[model samples]
Target: MTAVMAPSSSADDMPRPRLLERIGIPRALAWGFLGVLVFMVGDGVESGYLSPYLLEEGVSKERIALLFSVYGATASVAAWFSGALSDLWGPRRVMMLGLALWVVFQTVFLVFALPTVDFPLLLLGYGLRGFGYPLFAYGFLIWVTAVTPRRRLGSAVGWFWFAFTGGLPTLGSLLAGLAVPRAGAYATLWLALGLVVTGGAIALLLVREPTGRARLAPAGERPVATLLGSLAIIWRRPRVGTGALVRAINTTPQFGFLVFLPVFFTDTLGFALSEWLQLLSAMFATNIFFNLIFGVVGDRFGWQRTIAWFGGVGCAVTTLLLYYGTTAAGDNYALAMVLVSLFGATLAGYVPLSALLPSLAPDHKGQALSALNLGAGASTFLGPALVGLLLGPLGVRGVMWTFAVLYLASAVMTVFLRLPDSAATAAHPATDHPATGAPATDHPAA
Candidate 1:
């Protein structure tokens, strides 16, 4: 009798393409990201001057900060469950709910709160609006992880940040600059509301539900773990915890730095509004390229080292150079722009983290990714609060130097991050650790 041979499964059997091919990210998914970009640009139109608008409307600066604090806090808490809910109920249903809630809150803010300049109503409306974007955006992130192949996960995540960073506070600011001058903040916000509804609808239409992953049963049973219980994976894994920390560290400087950097450049430094805007554009453009570049690098070189050196140490050095270089360069605006652009480019090192965190928790990606967003949301509140407290006493240079130290601390933290044994085993089957079980090779985070 002839001996029967079983079919062999091997990495060689799987084709790995050039990172530039963008294989892991499907085309329709990219379009959905573009829809997200549209929604953000509208929402972000206020990024440049919301405080000034509020102050002009007679609200105290302290009150405005409190409003923002509430918004950030609410968003952070919402983010904690958005991913888990996506995992449990499916991304499509949760995202639709988020969009509907955003429309309702935004309309209320524009109609009732804006007309009367109602502080309490503003708090309620904006606070509810906070729940809108993270669910839509992070829910899509979970969708991305589910559909993309493991090999191209980093590149896909890079594109996610590309949409995220490129739209908000960058493109959004540019659009705001134009609109606030001609249309006024009130009308401009209406335009933003329209975009949120339209873009979210487009995303819903374009993106499809994932079929491959296991989901919580629709009717027969509750999940084995409660929503809170599901998050235990994060505490159990060192890599996941480090990822959350790194995400918080990566974003903290941006919020804190932006809080003062714009005014300092235009007012204190005596640069023209147009000149400062141009410099910002250049810096963010550099950031966009590096986001994609580092994603590819992470795939070839290794994600952890890429984040530790490029993200942690690179951010530390570049941040210092940006602050001190501007101070030392003085009247040399061109040189200052160069240093700032370099700072933005170095931030790309953290882009790979979207991919790395999910890889660390194959069995609990929804929970892991939610933790990542939780840290990000917390940073938005914490970073600015820290800068606000220190700004009076420390001054710009001193406060900025403190920001550099935070980056260094993040770098130090990265040393403890290690890929989960399951991921390692998937990569090299012969080296399987006894602790690892089923291989989780695809998932998402932001």
Candidate 2:
């Protein structure tokens, strides 16, 4: 199919803005990036040590696994809805609702559940709080895609993931490493609550992007229809569903790794909790950097090729290396760090899929994004569920192998996510809009 190109001046002839454009930050949504980074850091403060912390609080490993699985399930649902709701209610409104849910439920989890070690309360509160970040974060993502020129969408989304992951596991782990030792885990949790609120306030108040404040869908589109369309698009565009599956496999192991890797590194391998947190931070620090690198690479090298080979195949190889190589490294922290860093970098290889997926159904961008977000949320659930189920029978090595196999499968599935030849050509930088220098409005699939 021939993609339609919007008429515009050449981007090359247009005067480029300063550092933000150079660094791949969409100038229109800069505040949103800062907001997501801080907000996610608050959310992710517990990621490095939360499982072990629960065990110390008298929660069984089985229950901890269950808690995370439930949390993931809720997150998945919320992630899907974030897109659909964005279409109906506007991104800003959806973000507000998400922030409110997070604050209220998080307070319940901390004040009522954690203090008493009430398992039921813990599940209810934390699981429900899972709705918060995706709405706030992915809602902003829709905003980014709407305003960013098509030629730069990959880089813009890359910056989004860079901020999102950077805050969550990177700086978040680093913050935890310092805070847990100083203030204790419970107090550190309270600190996270404060950070989240502060970040949310900044984004809502400071960001002035007009598109996010109004519905992206047509004016007459009914809310129910928008919601239903989000689901129906999966079948109407089968490639989108395939892309969702690939997106799910992209991060299944990352979430699973959090469930067990801490214990493995600390208990089995003789590392301190702080050391492990440091390792986690270092690993994702590498990831945030490569998020930018791969964003640019995908724009130049072809998004599908980048995702298939670098994201899917490279991750498959690195997932195995991260497990076996680290094991073989014994007490060699330096070597282990290198292996883990490589794994983290490969994870960023899938960043382009965020740009690629929505382009598949531009006329239904919100619905298309819902499919992508569904996969994202499912991975959170699937990863931990896999660990909870397989860790008993298959053990860590077997679980690692399972993830590797899934990555390989994702690489193969990416073969089916091809774009039309003309659409692909339109997306190339050289053929971008002559006036604004933006790429064609009708984006290629995959």
lDDT by candidate, in order shown: 0.69, 0.85
**Clashes, model 1:** 1
TM-score of each: 0.85, 0.94
Per-residue lDDT of model 1, residues 1-446, tens digit only: 00011111221123543443344454436666787778777766666667657777998756776776777777776676666676667666767877887888989888999789999999989878888877877777766655555556677788777777776667777776777779888998898888888889788886553321234323443554536643665677766877787888887777676566766776677776556656766677688778888988988778878988998889889988887778776646789789878988888898877777766666566667777877777777766777667877898888878888888888888776667555643532332121121233322221
lDDT, model 2, position 382:
98
lDDT per residue (tens digit) for residues 1-446 in model 2: 11222221222234755577666666656888898899999998989999999999999999999999999998999889988898877788998998999999999999999999999999999989999888998888877776666777789899999989998789999999999999999999999999999889888998876667877777787889888888888888998999999999998999999999999999888888888999999989999999999999998998899999999999999989988887887756888789889999999999989888876765566788899999998988999999999999998899999999999999899887776775566555555454323454544354
The number of the candidate with the highest TM-score is 2
Q: List the residue pairs that clash in candidate 2.
A: 8-434, 8-435, 8-436, 9-434, 9-435, 9-436, 10-434, 11-437
Alpha-carbon deviation at 405 in model 1, angstroms: 1.2
**TM-score (C-alpha, index-matched) for candidate 2:** 0.94
Provide C-alpha RMSD values for all models, in order.
6.3, 3.0
Candidate 1 positional error at 190, Å: 1.8
lDDT against true structure, model 2: 0.85
Stretches off by above 4 angstroms in model 2 are: 1-16, 429-446
